[model samples]
Target: MAESQLLCMEDGLMPTAVPESRPQFYYSEQHRAALERLITGGDGAFKSLLKDENGQDFLSAREITAITSSFVKYKTDEENGGASAGQDKRDDAGSLHSTYWPQMSDTEVPPLDIGWPSSGLFKGVTRVAVHTHPPKDNGPHIKEVVRKLIQESSKVVAIVMDLLTDLQILRDLFEASKRGVPIYIVLDEPGAPHFLDMCNRLQVGARDLQNIRTRTVKGIGLNLSVGRIPGNVQSKYMLIDGDKVMFGTYSFSWSSSRMDRNMITVMSGQVVDFYDNDFRELYAISDKLDLFKQFHMTKPQTGTLSRAAVPKRPAAATSRFQVNLGDVTRGDGKVPAHKYHNPKYLLALGQIPGPTEPLQDFFNKMEPPDPETEQELENPTEELENLTPDPSPPEKKKSKKLKLSFKSKRGKKDKKSDEVIEENPANPSDEASKHTLTRDETQDSLKKKNTECMCVIA
Candidate 1:
C-alpha cells in the first residue's frame, strides 16, 4: 500500500510536490562561496561563472555610473579652454578636438589661387600684425611666420587701429618701413582711445624716423569679433598683402588683449583682394589729412564730408554679395538671427570656375571609391549566429504547445451536466429524499391541509 500522505510518484520514486515552476534562490553558503572566490582571485576569475558565456564585462548601472559621470565634466572643461575654475581633476588634460576639429563636410580647403595656397597640406601659416591677439610669447615663431608671409608673395601688412608711435608695433613698423614694405595704417575715429593713444605717443615722444615714411589709411567702420556675433553692428575687415584678412571686433586697445577672445583670421588668397580694395577706399579719403585733423578736433567743416560717410563696396559690382537674414527661435526664448541664403552670393558662386564641364558631367566622370574609405557594416547572419548557441535551431518559442491529458472529453461533458442538474431543483420523483419519517412532521403537514380545506368551504 502507498503512504497516506499525498505521494507524487514520478519515475517509480516519491517526489516532493512544488508550486508552479520558478527559479530557485541561492543559499547563503552558495553566496558566501562566490564572494570568497571574488575576494581571493579578483573579479576576473570569479566572473567566469556569472558571465553570460561570451565573457563580456557585465557591470550593473550602480557600479559604473560614477565613471561615466566624469566624461560630462571632462567635456565641459575642454570647451572653455580651462577658463572655468573648479572643474573635476580627472579632466585636467583636456583636449581641443571637441571644439576646433572641423567637420568632414565643412572641411574644404579652398584653392590658394591668386597667391593664396588653399591646398590642405601647408607646413602652416606665418601671421604678422600690429598686434596678434591670442598673443604668442615666442618672438622666434613670430619672426618665422612673418618671414614666410613675406617670402611667399606680395606681402601687404596693415596697421589696424591708430598707429601708436610709442607702442612696440611702431618698432616693427619702423623696421618694415625701412625695408620698403608697403604698410597701411588704418585708424579708428579721432577722439577714440586708439586715436588719443596715437596722438599722445607721437606728440609727447621723440620723432620716430619711421613716421615720415609710414603711410596711413583712415577708416570709418565698426569693430571685429571672433567666435561671437555683435549686437547688430557690422565690423570692418582689411586685407594685408593679399595674404590674410583682419576683421576687428573690439576697438584695438590694451583692454582687448588678454581680456577678450577677439581675433582675426590671417587668411590667404583671392580673399585678400576683397579686403585690399576696402582699405584702398578708406585710404582715398586720407589725402585730406588736414581736414581729418581739423574736423576730428571739433572744428566746424563746411563740405559734404561732414556728413556720415557711406562705406564703399569692397568687391566690384559683378562680384558683390547680397545678404539674406533669418530669425531662428532658440530654446531659451531668444530669437537668434542668422544668414539664411544670399541670392546674390549664389549668383556669384554660379560664376566660379569648375573643372571644365557641367556638375552632372563632373559627377558622372568621378571614379569609384579608393577602397581605403569603404567600411563594411557587420553581417546580420553573423550577429544572429553569436546570439544563438543552442547546438540546434531555435525551437520557435513553442508558440502554442499541444499536450495529451489523461482526462477524457466524455468525462468533462458528464461533469458539466452534473453541475447544471444540481444547480436547478429536480422534480419530486427525481428528488433524492422521497419522504418525511417523523410523526411530528406528519401532524404539521395534516394541520396545514385542514386549514386549507376550511378556507375553501367558507
Candidate 2:
C-alpha cells in the first residue's frame, strides 16, 4: 500500500479479506523506476525507449508545441543579437537581450542553484499558475495577474512594453500611481498617438503624468539587424516592487492575449534584481513623453473672430429667399430664384464662377469656369425656366441702380456711385480690379457671412 501511494491513482486499490492469499504488485512504482533510469541513463536509454515493442516512437502535441516555441524564441534571440546566449554566457548577453549589451543592462544574473539563487527561474516557485486562451475570447487570466500586481505593489513599478493601451490595465496603473508608488513606463514611439489618446480618454490630467513617468523608444534592438523595422520596442516585461517579475508575450493592448495565444510567467525571488537593473537602463536611453507637447493638446478656442470689418449680407434677402423655398410648393405656386439668374449666389455656393472673379479665392480652390463657355448651374427644366431672378445679380443699366457689392477705392458710396461703372464704361478690367479680392480677404468675408447664415438656420 505504501509503495502504491507513489502512483497518481484517482481510485485506490480494492480492499480484500484474503490479503496474503495472492501476492500484491505495485506496477506503477516499477514503471516510474524504469522511466527515471531511461532519462538518466544517457543516449542508449532513449534508443531503447524509442524502439519499444517492434515500433518507433512518435512526437505528441506537447512535443510539437515545445519545438515550435523553441524556434520562435531562437528567432527572437537572433534578432536581438543574443542567439548564442544559451551556448556561452561570457560571449554576450547570457539571458537578457538588449542593443547595447552589458552597458545597456548587466546580463549577469544570480547563479543557478537549488536555493534562493536559482538564477531568477524560481525558488520553490512560491506560486505557480498556467493559462491558455482560445480565439476571440477576452483571456482575462493574465489581465487579472497584472492588475493584482499593480494593486499590491508598494515600492516601485516599471513596465517596458511594445504597446500599453489596455484600459483596465491602465486604470490599475493609475490607481497605483495615486497611491504614490513611482510608476515607470516605456512604450514604442510608433504607438504614441494611441497612448496619448488613451490617457485623455481616462481623464488623466497632464499634471498627473509627473507621478507616472513615461518614455518612448524606437529603432531595432541591435545594429546588426538588417531588415528589422525601426518603429517597434519589441520587449515585453515588468518588474514590480523590486522583488517580483512578470514577463512574457502577453500584450497589454488590443492584440495577443485576447486575439491570439500568449503566456505570462510571474515569479518572486532575488531573480527580479536583474530585471530591475535592466528597466533602469531602458528608462535612461528612452526619450521623455510629454502628453501636452507631444499631442499638442490645449484648451479649445472659445469665442468666434470679430466680424466688424466684414460687410454683412442683407437679412431681408435671407428671409425672402426662405419664404420662396418654404411656401413655393404649398401656397399659390411661388418659386425660388433660378440657379442661372443669381450669379453672385451661384459663385458663393460654387455652382458657377462669376465674370469678374474666380471662386478659388472663396471656396475649396475649384478651378475657374471657362470664360467663353457658360456653365449650366442647374438642369433647364420646365419649372426652373419660370423662377424669377434674385437681387444678388446685376440688373440692366437703364433700371433704378447698379449695386457695387464690393468695396471701392473711392470708399463707401451711396446709390449715386453705384452707377459709376455702368454709366462711364472706360476700362472694364480696371474697374473690376478695384473690387478684386485677395484669397485671404475673400476667406474672411465668407467666414463672417457663413457664421451669420449658420446662426439664423442652425
Candidate 3:
C-alpha cells in the first residue's frame, strides 16, 4: 500500500488513503535551527556547495535558489511515505514525524540562497557573474576576463570600443581568429588601424581567411549628419557567443588597467542580449574594409617614378622672328625669354654701372672721425701691442752683470794718480770752484743746451 502511494505521488496523482489530520508543510524547530546555522555561517557553507569538484566557483544565483527548493521538496516527499517507506513496517505517525523533522546532525542543510531568477529573460544560460574594476570583491582581473571569454567562446566573439590599445587583448583575439572562430569588431576609425594590423598578422599563414571581420565606426556611430565629422565612441564592451558580456568604463588598453580608474562587469544571461544587439547595430554602420583583398592586391611598381609621361616639348616655332615678337617687350625694353634661358646672360657682362655723378660725389665727401676713434689714437702703441702677439717668451731668464775689482798689487800706481788729484785740493779756492757752480750759472747753461737741441731738431 505504501509502495502504491509512493508511485501515485511520483505520477502527480493523489493517493486514495488520506491522513486524518492535514500534514504540516512548515519547518520544524530542528529544521529551522539547521537553516539558521547555515545562514549565519555567511558564504563559507554556501561556497562549498557552489564550488564544483575541481573547486571552480561557477554556481549562479538561480542554481542556488533551485538547490534550496529541492531540499524543501525532498523533506515533504519523505512525509508522504516516499524515501524510507520500503525499509520496514513502522507506525505511520512515528515514521511521518521522523521523516518530516529529522535530527540536525542527521539531516544536511542547503547552502545560502544565491537569489538568482531560474527562468526569465535569457534562455539556455545557467550561470551569471558580475565583477567591477578597482574591484569591490576579489574577482578576476579585466584581462583575465577577456582571455577567458575568447578561450571559452565557441561560435562568435563581438567587440566594440572607442579605443583598443591593449596588446594582450589583441593577441587573444588573434588566437581566437586562428581557431576559426568568427570574430566581429567595431572600433573607432582612429583605432581601426591597430585592430586591422593584428588581423593581418594572424592571416599570414592561415588557410581560412574569412574568420575575422572588422569595421570602423565614426564616434561610435553617434554623428548624425553633422557633415560626417568623426565622433567619440567612448564605449568599451565585448560580447562572447551572444550569451556573455563584459563591459564598463574600462577600455581595452594598457593604460586603462594600470593608470585609469575604471570599472568592468562580467555577466551572462538576459542582460547580454541587450549588449549583443547594440554591438550588431554599431557594426552595421561600420566602415567595412576588405582586409584580405587590400593586403593581397597587386601593388603598383614601386621602384619606377609615378609621374605622368612627359608630353613632347611643343615643336619649336618654325620661324624665329614673328610679327608679334615686338609686342612681347615691356615698356622698359625688357623682352620675355623662355624659362630655359641661361641666367648669366640676363644682365650686362661688365661690372655693374656706378651711381650717377651727384650721388657718387655725395658719398665721397668724408665725415670727421668719431670722438671715440680719436681717443683711441692717443695711445697707439698700447693699442697695437694689444692687437698683436708678443714675440718674447713668457718665462725668459735675466742676464747677470759682470763685477770688476782692482787688487792691492797696483797700490803704487793708484797712489801716484791720487797725489796728482790731491794737489788741486790743496788750493782751497780752486778746489771749491771745481766742486760747485752758482744757481744763475746753472740755469744759463741748461737754457743754452735746450736751444742747441731745438736747433738740431729743426
Q: By TM-score, who's the top model here?
A: 2
Cα lDDT of candidate 1 equals 0.38
Which lDDT tens digits does candidate 3 get at residues 1-458?
A: 23543456475675455432556322222323333333445346646543432343434666445434332211345577665655444645455435464554452332112111122354455465666555566777766777788888777777888777677777777677678677777788777777667556655433334466667776521111111122457878887766677888887878778777776777776677677667756765567756666678442332666899888643233343321223223222222232113244323211222222333344365355444323333345633332222233435312111111222333344321100111122343563566344434544543443333221110
**Residue 44's lDDT in candidate 2:** 55
What are the lDDT scores of the predictions, listed in order? Answer: 0.38, 0.55, 0.52
In candidate 1 the C-alpha lDDT for residue 195 amounts to 46
- How many Å off is the CA of 25 in candidate 3? 57
- Candidates arranged by TM-score, highest first: 2, 3, 1
Pitting candidate 2 against candidate 3, the one with the higher lDDT is 2
Clashes counted in candidate 2 amount to 0
Model 3 ranges with Cα > 4 A deviation? 1-128, 197-209, 220-228, 297-458
TM-score of each: 0.26, 0.35, 0.35
lDDT of 1 by residue, 97-158 (tens): 34564555343322211132222333244543543445556433222333344444244455
How many backbone overlaps does candidate 1 show?
A: 8
Candidate 2 lDDT, 341-404, residue by residue in tens: 4666554444332234444453454445444234342334621332222264344423422233
